[model samples]
Target: MPVNRRITLAARPVGHPQESDFALDEVDVSSPEAGEVLVRVLWTSVDPYQRGRMSEAKSYAPSLQVGDVITAQSVGHVVESNDRRFSVGDLAVGQLGWQEYATARAGTVRPVPEELDPQTLALHAVGMTGLTAYFGLFDVGKPRAGDTVVVSCAAGAVGQIAGQLAKIAGCRAVGIAGGPEKARDLIELYGYDAAIDYKNDGVAEALRGERVDVYFDNVGGEISQAVHRRLNLGARIVICGQVSQYNAERPELSFHPGLLIMFRARMEGFLVFDYAHRYDEAARKLAHWVASGKIRWREHVTDGLENAPRAFIGMLNGENRGKALVKVAERAE
Candidate 1:
């Protein structure tokens, strides 16, 4: 049996996750039983949403208990299979957590499309992140052509794709991110019409006297409040990940009720998993956009599974440019 290394939640984090909150453990891998497959994880995603799971808080998803393997989406290849749906050496993606090996029933994991090169993309664009942006923007945000769509945390994995999708819908894309370099990437790389560096350039000042038709809010707090004040009539606000509030023990109170009434804006929060039946619809479109160069993506990959804690911490601190991932093992050659 192979020794499987995994990261487990050691303690609930205070404000921000510390390295001590996670523990690395090694265990013997177990073979798959009937209707299951054993996978050697290649790429693991470290998203801001994972921060919410680290704490015992009421959330859309259940909080992770102490000693549980940190929740994550992973891309891997099946090494052994007891299910006809999957065969040895097939690529798969699922909520496989932070581990070198994982066992799952075939129904729980999806086969990776063979055209998706660098299989790591299954954990980033053309995968969950892309689907999140696709459903959140199109289904919830309901952006219209010629509208101005503003996205917070604009340089993040979902944020980057959301901004581009907004542009593809013929909306004027505006992005708000921290740091000058990220702001530049929002415009030059992600193709946002305008980029605001909230850390340096004031968000309110940059967006002053502007009318926002849609807001794809990724980080909620004062930044969202600033955008709220400038909403155009009948604006739509898609409540995506609230990265800024994830670390807080108590929710950061903001968002005046009057803004919604004044703007007649629709604010909706959705989970990508809720659209499971339509995942193939979104994936096919995202894959086409990516292949045709309509969408661009980047990955900030931390080298080893042992460094997952560091990568998660860095990602929470806005240190990563795009999708933050842990490269657990090399892809089978």
Candidate 2:
């Protein structure tokens, strides 16, 4: 039997995931049982949602138990198979963990498009991150022509796609990011009409210049408060994420009931998993846009599995430029 390296949850974290919260170990590998396959991990996505999983707080996904492998979305190639549906060398994407290899049930793993670029397909503009942007913007935050749409965390994976989708819908798009460079990229690279550096400027004043009919909020706290104040009557706010307050000991702001009355606005939260049935539709549309050179994706990939913890921590701190991924193994050509 071969042995594989795995990273497991050493302890439940309080706020942000720490090095002490993870334990790296080498474990014996077992052959795939019936209807299962053994995969050599190629890439693993690190997302903000994982932080919520590290805590005991209730969420869409269950908290990781101590001593269990840290769960993550992984892209890999099958090295051995017990199911007839898959064979050796088949590329698949599924929920594996932070490990060099994994044994996944046949039903959970899906084959990746053979023609798609492996690296790009793993991180951005195609996978869960892209789907989140697609459904959230079109289905939830419906921006019509001439409507002003605002997105927070504008330079991130989902934000970049949502902003571009708003533009495609003929809306004037504005973005709010943490820094000047990201602000510039949101405008120049992602086609946002305007971008505000939230770290340096007054977010409310910057957004008030435009009639914001839709606000795609990724960062909550004061930023959400600012957007709430500037929302036009009947505006729709899509509560995507609250990255800013994810690490806080306690929520910084209480929900403002007054804004709901003053603007007659609607605020709704959505999870991408709810739209799983429409993933194919969203993928087709996103792929068409990518092929036409209409939408651009950015990724921050770290080189090794050893760096996964650091990469993930940095991503939560807004250090990554786009979707963050860790390369675990190279695929055979």
Candidate 3:
């Protein structure tokens, strides 16, 4: 019997996570049965959303109990298959968890389309991360040409793409990132016309001159409070994520909604799954942008499955410049 190494929730954290909160263990993995396939996990995703999933309190998705393997979106090749749709060696993507191998139903894993450039594309630009940026920016924010689009967490995965997409739509892209270096990348690399270093300068002061028409918010907190006060008439605010307050030990203090009534703007929160029916359409457009060199993606990767916990913590700490992922194993050429 072969062993599969796994990362499981050992203890739930009161605030910021501890390394001891995770347990790495090895167990014998089951083979694929009829109508199933066994995936040799390659690349696994670590997102801020996982922090929400760790708590027992209910949200959009179910929470995980202690000792359960951490659930995650992963990409890998089929090592064994009992279903006709998935053949051995075919690359597939699914919520496979943090493990070396997993057996999933044929319907649970979707084969990555051939047109997608790289096998790892399942994790970032052409995947859900990109799609979140797509629907949040286009459908929610609804920016137009010459509109000023402001993005928070602008150096991270979705933020970087969101800023670029605004530029592609002929909008003035303004970014708010943590450091001077990330802020510089926002202007030089991500095609942002203006960039703000929230770590050094005042976010509200940085946008004093620019007319903010649409705001794509990722790390909501004081930054969001500042942006909401500067909204132009008919402005749209897309609430993506609130990473800044995700790990607080106590309940976070939220700002009053006086500005919403004052600005007469629209502020809406959305889950990417809400747009599942339109993913293919979004993917087609995003793929075109990537091939034409308009949208770009970067990955901050950890090398081993055993290190998955650290990778997750790093992402929550704002350590990644782009998408945060764990490389579980190498693909065979």
Clashes within 3 Å, all models in order = 0, 0, 0
Worst 10 residues of 1 by lDDT: 245-254
Q: What would you estimate as the lDDT of candidate 1? A: 0.92
lDDT of 1 at 231: 96
The TM-score between candidate 3 and the true structure equals 0.96
Please identify which of the two predictions, 1 or 2, would achieve the higher lDDT against the true structure: 1
**lDDT ranking from best candidate downward:** 1, 3, 2
Tens-place lDDT per residue, model 3, 214-265, is 9998888799888877889888989898888778755464446776777788
Q: What stretches of model 2 exceed 4 Å from their correct place? A: none
List TM-scores for all candidates, in order: 0.98, 0.96, 0.96
* Model 1: per-residue Cα lDDT over 180-281, one tens digit each: 999999988999999999999888889996899999999999999899999999999999978888887777865988888999988889999999999999
Worst 10 residues of 3 by lDDT: 248-257
lDDT by residue for model 2 (199-244), tens: 9999888877776799999888888888787888989989899888
The most accurate candidate by TM-score is 1
Q: What overall lDDT goes with each candidate model?
A: 0.92, 0.86, 0.87
Residue 13 in model 1: lDDT? 91
